[model samples]
Target: MSDERSLATDRRGAAAHPQLCAGRRARLAEAMARLGGGVAVLPTAPERQRNSDNDHPFRHCSHFHYLTGFDEPQAWLLLEADGRSTLLCREKNLEREIWDGHRVGPAAAPAALGVHEAHPVDALDKIATDKLANAPAVWFPFGVHEGLQARIDGWLATLRERERLGVQPPQAQRDLTPVLAEMRLLKDEHELGTMRRAARISAQAHARAMRFSAAHFRSTQGRGLPEYMIEAELLHEFRRHGAQSPAYGSIVAAGANACVLHYAAGDAELRPGELCLIDAGCELDGYASDITRTFPADGSFSAAQRELYDVVLAAQEAAIAATRPGARKQDAHWAAVRVLAQGMLDSGLLNRDKVGDVESVIDSGAYRAFYMHGTGHWLGRDVHDVGEYLSLDEAPVEQPDGMGGRVVKRPSRVLQPGMVVTIEPGLYVRPAEGVPERFWHIGIRIEDDAVITDNGCELISRDVPVAPREIEALMRG
Candidate 1:
């Protein structure tokens, strides 16, 4: 299908329900009003050429989409504090439409998108300059789009040129990122519904990949199964379930490759006994769902693989337990760390004689060798969604510096209802002198998307079996 047709199909429902975007814009405008009124300019992401006339898939800016719900390129949204919205979009070109499929031309934009006004993209310079004149503040996302600051400067320069004509440029320039980030951090009913669907699709994809790995390994006697093959299965399942795209590049690491975090799906053979770590997700509508599962290739985990998998699973459980309203975000990481540290000590991954006890191991950073990255990150529109991790209003508190010392740092943002996070705890055991050989080259990460609730956290991506026996049972089928 043509790109424009596909985009239209994807957003048909959203276009019909204009209140979602309208409500978000109202909230942002109210925020601007609180800051004493201003004009906000936001541009959608620009399309980039991949190589030699071919272009990468176009994705609208999350912030822009959050406000406008428009997906086309060469578009900009102008929001005024008085609740007026103006959209500058590409003009309808019959010639271009022949190749691109459809354009939500300026004539239909107001009614189609529920914006107050619409104009062709070329009018942004003149319109923005006019809007900025006599404004108390001009708000735009700082340091996001390349050349955005320069463009704003150019607009301000134009306004300054007309200073003698009683044209007054904005006196204050504020970043819109923080405002939008705080807004996007919480998922509304619409966003939550979309995310739940995404999580279900991603869970199914992971399950499909697991079963394919076991079935292929057995059918070919462990000869032809490759990481990309499993990745293909994931992509297939994602699209099969109507997901627009993978949330990020799928990580389909096999055996030792799993030790390297962020390993892209490659041609590594999926050996029978070694574990496969599939860290992947799917993007449905504009929301994202992230999930990771580590499973054995031949259906049953090896003794060592199962041991580490159990530890990572337990750590994820602890993290999930801590993901509730009113709990600080870092509380989940600390909970996961405590479980992982204890598991490492008991499993001999960390020598108890050398690292002392779990607390000592944690304080001394001895657990860094096996478990490196944090337990989780915010999950939403973007995979590593835009939201401040630290609390803005809270005072700094003294916490362990990980070196048997104390340091003052601002606490993480407190989890609240409607917040979405990924509870991913991983252990990558590389061959080291004191590390057990049995645990070497084992990398296990169990992740699930959790939605913070008033009662507790809801694991949205649990359709796939997490237990060893359950996974074995699924693969056996």
Candidate 2:
């Protein structure tokens, strides 16, 4: 949390750097005014080195940068609703810059970030305490940092027993979710453009993986290839295509491994003839793009493979078609689930696939056995970008029906313009060892990033292979 311990060098030549900073400042200003002038503490997440000698690269907090736009660690962004933003950063040191790289310490932070004030990070605690003191309300993410909360408490306690009679804390200490989430709903042009580039790079990575599947594809039959290898290939491609890094962990699940939604370790290999589901995305300039594709390891699906893959792909396509303004985020999921449940019902896998049963599963999400995980996630900034998915009326949007009940349990955030999210509806059938002959090791998932528009949505990764023949062609080409 200190520049003394920071691994970052100074900023290099990049026009995007300043623009990124200014854009976030705009969002912060809007939020600060809404909450009544108060100080908001935005902390930068520090870098965790890969090892003692090899430090990991620092990735700025999307939300924090969305406001302050400072790229240094141990930095704190102070936004005073009075209409001023200041960045507190590490002071520059010749020794460190020569050792690591150039730094945007206190001196350079103002010009670099377009802030009204700049100070050394060392002054953060004192400055924050002074600014937060006596304010009617203090705005800080309590659970996000216990120390900050305790500081607020101490500041309040000091005020209550005030040697200074006029200073006092405000009555309400609310979570800062309302304005922050609301501001992130509509993507500014800059955000949308960055996300578009990320989607484009993500598409290239998927295509590269498809074309070079053999060099790294898994093929052990019952067992699969190491999930990590597929992740490596994608990472290689992402960097080659100018992606700063993966937006999140690359989920490289092979066969039954895919059954575990959000699989962590990428150790499993693609079993020969089995499916390898790659749920991965990369960040281009802090904008995120998520894409998933499941394909056979042998570059061809069996009759059953095609059956299940086609079902998921079909459901995804249908869902994609239904995304539009006025449509809810849940709408697409509802449509995809019904279609997938019907596919399972027709295949005799679910044993029930009628209007009533499908509707029930759509309502209860019983088909999760094969089609687990949400249809998609918000895509931008953080991989699961910010924004409300539900409408003000609280009606569910494109969310698939037949999911578990509980409104909060479901992300009813309405779909709106300038939102980018992935539309990935999948089906995974993992038969217990020697349990059922009807089901066996199989997991198929197809995912794509879609940009929500005013009337409809645009498929950004249309270049990625989704159709069976196209995948085959890409692999064979």
Quantify all predictions' global Cα lDDT against the true fold.
0.90, 0.72
> lDDT tens string, model 1, 1-477?
852234224433355677889989999999999988999999999999999979999998999988888999999999999999999999999999999879998999999999999999999998999889999999999999999999999999999999999989999999999999999999988888788888988998899998888888778876857888899999998886678999999999999999999999988787888899999999988889999999998999888888888888888888888889989998889899999999998899888988899889889888888888888898989999989999899899988765557889998888999999999999998998988899888999999999999999999999898999999999999
| RMSD list, candidates in order | 3.3, 6.0
* Candidate 1, residue 60: how far the Cα is off, in Å: 0.7
lDDT of 2 by residue, 349-374 (tens): 77662334776766776777677777
Total clashes in model 1, counting residue pairs 3 or more apart in sequence or in different chains: 0
Best by TM-score: 1
TM-score of 2: 0.86
Best by the lDDT measure: 1
